[model samples]
Target: MTTDRISRQDARRNAIIQAARACFRDKGLHGTSMADIAREAQLGPGQIYRCFQNKDAIVEAIIKVIISARVEHMLAVNHDLVRKADEFTRSLAGIAAFDSRDDALLLEISAEATRNPRIAQLVVEADLNLFEQGCAMLKARYPHLDTIQVNALSEVMAVLTEGTLLRRHVRPHRPIDAQCLQSNYLAILHTLFPDTQSNNTRKKD
Candidate 1:
């Protein structure tokens, strides 16, 4: 295809994905239809169809966008996490705000995944990909950790992240103290990594 045609296709795909996210957030997966997405995108149903085979394709695209964002954040972390422990811990605690539109959309998709086998598979695959990426980051930063430890740490982080996301839905109005959040994350980091010098000093003082 010509360059202009490719650009138009890309633009349409993005519009469809953005529209799908909003619809899924508002009406959920099963409730949202192609017509709804078309209206949201301000495009005809045929145009949306030209970009994606079905709603599932748009959902998959949305998952990819989420993965890209998360992986980019992971990549931005310093390799020497021990030395940057305070900074890293604070970054983790910053997630406590839980005001992300993407988080809401993911929660909706996760709920739908439990009942839809195809969606469950896609979610599982995306989760595994994220897990592997996280593990790779951990291994690079802490080469002394064995594979089991690295995997366990990655799983713990995943649990913490998902749990925080769940809390966002259950208690959206709850206010979390940033200082307390940082302290709690610091404790978790110290416990998991087991530094005898700096972490212990901070814990004591």
Candidate 2:
């Protein structure tokens, strides 16, 4: 394909993905259809098909985009560890960064993955990618830590993130204090990265 054609196709695919996200947020994955996405995107159904073979393909693309975003966020956090270590701990405590709608979509997709082999494959692959990238970040920040330690720390981080999201969704009424949450998470971070925490304290002093 020509460069112009590829660019147009890419743009078209992005528009469709954005539209599908809106539809999914409003009507959910199973509730939304190709026609609804087309209407939202202001594109024809044929255009949507040309960009994506079906809704599954579109979901895969959306997941890819979310993963890409998360990778970028991880890189940013890694950078903060080097330059603004104290801020990194505070960032961990701030739960507002995660969008509930996005979490819902991920949970919905995960539920679908149980029944759909293709989606299950995508979830497995995306998770592995995230975990590996997370390990790399930890290794970079705490080079003194061995492979096993870094791997364990990465798993802890993943659990903390996903578990926090689940708790917020499942128990929205049971609100936790912001100060208490920050203090507790800071203690966990200090325990996990003692060297960084000491460095952060020294900088503060």
| Top lDDT model | 2
True-vs-predicted CA distance for residue 90, candidate 1, Å: 8.6
RMSD of each: 4.6, 4.3
Inter-residue clash pairs, candidate 2: none
* Model 1: per-residue Cα lDDT over 77-187, one tens digit each: 543344334443333444432237788788888889998888898899999999999998888767878899999999987886677666655755545576666566667
Pairs with steric clashes in candidate 1: none
TM-score for each of the candidates:
0.84, 0.83
Which tens-of-lDDT digit does each residue in 1-205 have in candidate 2? Answer: 8999999989999999999999988887778899999999999999999889999999999999988988887787663433233433334444445455777889888887888888899999999999999998877777778999989988987887787666656764544566666566667766666786567789999
Give, for candidate 2, the lowest lDDT window spanning 10 residues: 81-90
RMSD of 2: 4.3
Each model's lDDT comes to 0.78, 0.79
